[model samples]
Target: MKTNTTTVNGIDTQALLGAIEAIRNNPAEAQSKWHVTSHWKGGTRSETKVKSSQLGNQTIAKDFTIGIDEPLELCGTNQFANPQEYLMAALNACMIVGYTALTALEGIELEELRIETEGEIDIQGFLGLDPSVKPGYDHLRYTVHLKGDGTPEQFERIHRTVMATSPNYFNVANAVPLKSKLVLESPATV
Candidate 1:
């Protein structure tokens, strides 16, 4: 099927779809696949726990501890993934994987790929100073480093493809509709 492209928040959506299609067409050369879930725990330290479940088992878990508490250690039962850092990590990881897969499918020899992301947040929202404001990232920026044997044009195309198609990238760059649902679990009396 032919993929149609649209621009969202400065990203070329059509080119991104083409890149993903190219990668999916060649599955044998993919690098990594994983899923993650996280839950928030309200209290001091503002901690959160994230788990990675795969193949019917919880294989890995990490704690995201934030606040002014001596920089939570990532060694014991609790680790740190401070909210902002986690956001950057997600973007970096997604871009690396997406770019790698796309390059492999396009027959480009990629020696190295690195991505760095930074985000800014407003404190007013967190402190409840403004009810109309949202407590989320105000701006995000990314820098990508690529080393390969492709022309400047090819490299630019590959970069565009990765930025447009990556799920994490889309989550931050596009206007995605989100819905919240509450599920209550209770014990049944017999």
Candidate 2:
């Protein structure tokens, strides 16, 4: 008997299933490492270079440079995206992936989907002027706009699943353990 190959909203479910099967067979294949190097420019301007990602024993090279800055009101040059914008972007992007993949897996074809996210930060905390203030966002609000072949109930279920499964969503929504090490640069000499 011949089986139908499925592709919904440009997502190849068969390929996704194959990857899931591969990871199931060798759980170690689920390991993924991402790397980036950032250079700080004067007055809140900086650039981060994403060079590669490591999956198991293989290194995949996909180079891209991202620039970040703050608005003049925040003492930055306002040249590129600010760190807060990037934070929301990362969270949205990760959740979108889960949304799309899950939609495809459910055999639903998507017509449109998007998420709007916003948050507030206390600068006083960052500036060390207020010891009790938190430097990061205390609460984040997001709204999802979705239209697809699936019913509203199905979409709502998928949204919940995405929230539970998205890596960056969990990272941002929870207090993840962070470790830091600092190495002072040697003074330049001519």
Candidate 3:
């Protein structure tokens, strides 16, 4: 299938592409700012905790605690997917919010929105069943349900904006340079 390209509000594709490329190459000079932090506690299921804080006038914080014996049959408590599902959920949630904000900013009224995401994972590597496989999701897909009065072109533009701007979506889709450090503390012998 042939890919489609269209811009919003009569914006030129070249201009949009140039703007995106400039931001990617010179992020420090970009006009937009993003500041957020997330903290998590506990392992396994006994207690899974998460909190996120954003910098803004309307600050908010929420927590999610998972029980040990919840049903996980179909994306629920008991069958909680390891960590990958959590990552997918983050992406889905971020995309929904990002799209909603973009549409609202564009003066579009949306009655409802829903996003369903699924990720396929291979467990052979983690289970030591296959030495050559990697323990991660091989494929991910998502469907967006939007209720609004707009042309297909408008929806496409909104979709692109969400995909390009969402932090979680970018983290998963792009290569981000990351580093890790380990700290050890011990009591000194007198």
Candidate 4:
């Protein structure tokens, strides 16, 4: 049997439209906050757990654990992806969502889409060997390979849309204010 569900590029356009309308009608519903915790395992190894999120005054439970490690040269076991990889992954995932949604909204079907990202960092600052060195990545360069029935102009438009709209894209391209606090615990606290 054939269904009348409206889908484009595997996205439910009908539901998407409905959600967009809902968010427009209730702007507070569009607000969300993600929460996670990272714990150091040992010597350059750490793991993060995504436990919950707040959306429009409602708590949403999320279950996800991600392992992180560094290369042997950096003093880690090379067990899992490093933080840099995760950052790029988040950026790529956000872009994927933007491309999928925008393309679907514009009635474009996608056959293939891939984004490759690379960045360079200086270890001197991390190791505290140099006072003038910056610890983070200098910059990240990425290439998107896309193939579909859309015109070159359409693809370029989507690319621009993703760059403008992707949350992780914006986060990485611009500096975001981070408010952090330190809590000291004694051995008997646990």
Task: Give me the runs in candidate 4 sitting further than 4 Å from their true place.
Answer: 1-5
Best by lDDT: 2
lDDT of 4 by residue, 20-133 (tens): 998899999899998889999999899899999987778998999999999998889999998889999999999999999988888877889899999888889889999899
Please report, in order, the local distance difference test score of every candidate based on alpha carbons.
0.64, 0.91, 0.65, 0.90
Residue pairs with backbone overlap in model 2? none
Better candidate by lDDT, 2 or 3: 2
lDDT of 4 at 111: 88
| Candidate with more favorable, higher lDDT: 1 or 3 | 3
lDDT per residue for candidate 1 within 98-133, as digits (tens), equals 777666555566666778777776767877899888
Q: Estimated TM-score per prediction?
A: 0.59, 0.94, 0.61, 0.92
Model 1 segments more than 4 A misplaced: 1-78, 184-190
lDDT of 3 by residue, 100-147 (tens): 666654655566678988877676876778978887767688999988
Task: Check candidate 4 and list the clashing pairs.
Answer: none
Those runs of model 3 whose alpha carbons end farther than 4 Å from true positions after fitting are 1-43, 46-82, 184-190
Residue pairs that clash (backbone atoms under 3 angstroms), model 3: 70-78, 71-78, 71-79, 72-78, 72-79
Top candidate when judged by TM-score against the true structure: 2
**Model 2 per-residue lDDT tens digits across residues 79-129:** 999999999999999999999999989987777889999988889999999
